[model samples]
Target: MEQKAAAKAKAPKRSQFSGMSKALVRRETISAYLFLLPSLFFFVGFVVVPMFICLIYSFFNMGLDSTSTTFAGLSNYVRMFQDPVFIRGFWNTVLIVVVSVPAVTAFSLWVSSAIYQMKPAVRSFFRCVFYLPVVTGSVAVTVVWKWMFNPYNGLLNQMFNTVGFDWLGNTKTAIWCIIMILFTTSIGQPIVLYVAALGNVDQSLVEAAQVDGATKLQVFWKIKWPQIMPTTLYILIITTINSFQCFALIQLLTSGGPSNSTSTIMYYIFYMVYRYNDFGYANAMGVVLAIIIAIFSAIQFKVTKTDN
Candidate 1:
């Protein structure tokens, strides 16, 4: 009888301990959510709400004057297809994305592979060198590039003995110059990411592969590549988006000039909003650009998932 009474008394204490743990977990969860609330509020208020507003505005004929708003219902979208400047801008945007993404991915991977095996201090030095451009303000970088590409007495022209040649003014060379600048600015983050990813790769697997007499390329393809697929996908998508939104360079350098040869969809969207006060059309273009980015990201995700 005494043993049974003792067992009953201990069972109540066990239940009380369990209940206390449950309450503690609930309290911690609430505290965590409370900490997240501020970020959640801003994300919803700025990003999510603005996105929906843009989508809604895209279907209307909105202007600077709010009283002029009217339902346009696909007219803005239809106009985009018919606009020649938009068409040119679309092609230019595509060219940037196509050229920049692969180049950045390949170059970053190569550079990372070379440097990741180096001593820690050496690796850090290279990482800082590459990442400097990324951390530098876009406007400052553009100014330096602008000075370099200046037609008269520019460093590039001085070096080439073509001091009077206007690089940004020539229709043939303008887009290419922009592409080159974009390439330089875009490679930094990818290199840093790739270095980290490569460093994190399974050393054991690499050693085993080497023991089996695998070539360096074989080990990379069979071991390292698969592990870094996620990082590569992220780099691809971000580079694509950045390339698509190649605006400040064009704005500061060419302003979509020299017969619109350097025009991109993003620049065109800004031009529409500021020059024509065509909010509806600009929002429509924004929507289309968003869709294109999403599609590209999806394709990258699918490909990377398959490879993984």
Candidate 2:
């Protein structure tokens, strides 16, 4: 009886403290949210409100010149699924993201690793050369690339013809040329990020590995690679997101032409809204793209967590 009474007394104290703790938690949450009020207001006004409008607008037939919105529900989404251009655009974006992400990421990492071994001045010179393309506008780059890929007069075709091969005029060759152009133009920022990451890698670890008789390749693969994994993930995520929204390059370089082979989702969206007067379906595409990009960025953050 005594023991049971003691247990009963302890339970009420624990319960009382638990209740107080939960109240305190609620208070803290309210305070935190209060602190977040101003930023949240701006976020809601800009991002959240626009997102909500897009979501609602995506389900309505809001044509140009029509002041009234008619309910479309899943009609726009269903039509998008059946749309061949939309399908092609979706697939092309995926293709570019998959190919370009790894190519740019790996090449940047390799180049940065090489540059990491060089003198500061030499490294700066190379970094500046690589990054010069990044500051130059994408439209200008595409225009220059268009000229460079010209069937007769372009430097690329000239080189190919010099090597006694037909180039750039062929559908296959032109597509590859476009890919190389996009790849080269996008390589700069990734290279810079990789350079920063490489700079942070510990010299002590590299020396320790060498003292343990680790070869250059092994040291790089095991030590340097792991150290820069976080930076690589960031680069990959940003590149993937940016690749999806590629408009200027496609619009300028090929305009999804040579038979719409290079049409990306963003280009498709732009045309659907701006050219075709289909705001409903465009909103659907935008929302879906935004959701995908958010999910990818979240995955990147989780994967790169140092605690992991």
Candidate 3:
């Protein structure tokens, strides 16, 4: 009878504890959702709504005037292929992506591997040095680069003693100059991410591999590479997307000039919308560009997953 009474007393306490936990969880969940509300509101309003609007507009012949709009029904998309300027822009965009992505990834990984094991202060200093251009305004960076690439008074020409050589004017060198700038700005974020990823690698596995007579290369490939694959995948996708959206440099520096040699799909899209009032075509190009980015991201995802 005493044991039964003791059991009966404990059952209420257990039930009460469970009830308190449920209430606490419910309250915490409500707080979390409340915290998320602002971000969700902006994301839905700005990004999701705009995407849907652009997709809908792509199928119509749109312009600055609403009355001018009519059903285009894929004609704008069809016209993209037939347009020579767009073709050139497409290939140029492709070249930028092809060149920038691999170079940025390799260089960032190399720098991170070299610096991640340094003292905290030294590591942070190097991180700031690499990341300066990223935090600096794009306009300022472009202005400095523009002065450097100036034909007569620029540093490059003066240093080389090739006075009045238009680096930004020449068809062959213009795109490359843009590429170099893109490379500098692009590596900062990747390097930071890679440093964090590399620092988080399993030190025990790495030490064991080294103890087994594995060389640095062997240990990296066998142990560290798989661990940092996710970071690598992220870097590849972001770099690829940035390369595809190569617009600011082109606009501020070249404006797709020198016989349209430096023209990219992004610049072309801008030209179409503002210059020609071709909203439909611009939206179609945007849709296509989005699709291309998606495909490339998917490929990277698949390849990285397989490697891991």
lDDT of each: 0.92, 0.80, 0.92
Higher-ranked by TM-score: 1 or 3: 1
Distance (Å) between predicted and true CA of 28, model 1?
6.2
Error of 3 at 256 (Å): 0.9
Tell me the spans in candidate 2 whose CA falls farther than 4 Å from its real position.
1-43, 162-170, 294-308
The TM-score of candidate 1 is 0.90
**Model 1 weakest lDDT span, ten residues long:** 14-23
User: Candidate 3, overall lDDT?
Assistant: 0.92
State which candidate has the highest TM-score.
1
Cα error of candidate 2 at position 49, Å: 2.4
Q: What is the TM-score of each candidate against the true structure?
A: 0.90, 0.80, 0.89
On residues 4-42, what C-alpha lDDT tens digit does candidate 2 reach at each position? 768998987777546467779788889999999999999
lDDT of 3 by residue, 10-33 (tens): 998777546467779789889989
Which ten-residue region of model 2 has the weakest summed lDDT?
A: 162-171
Residue-level lDDT tens digits of model 1 in 58-111: 999999999989999999999999999999999989988998899889999999
Candidate 1 clashes between residue pairs 3 or more apart in a chain or in different chains: none
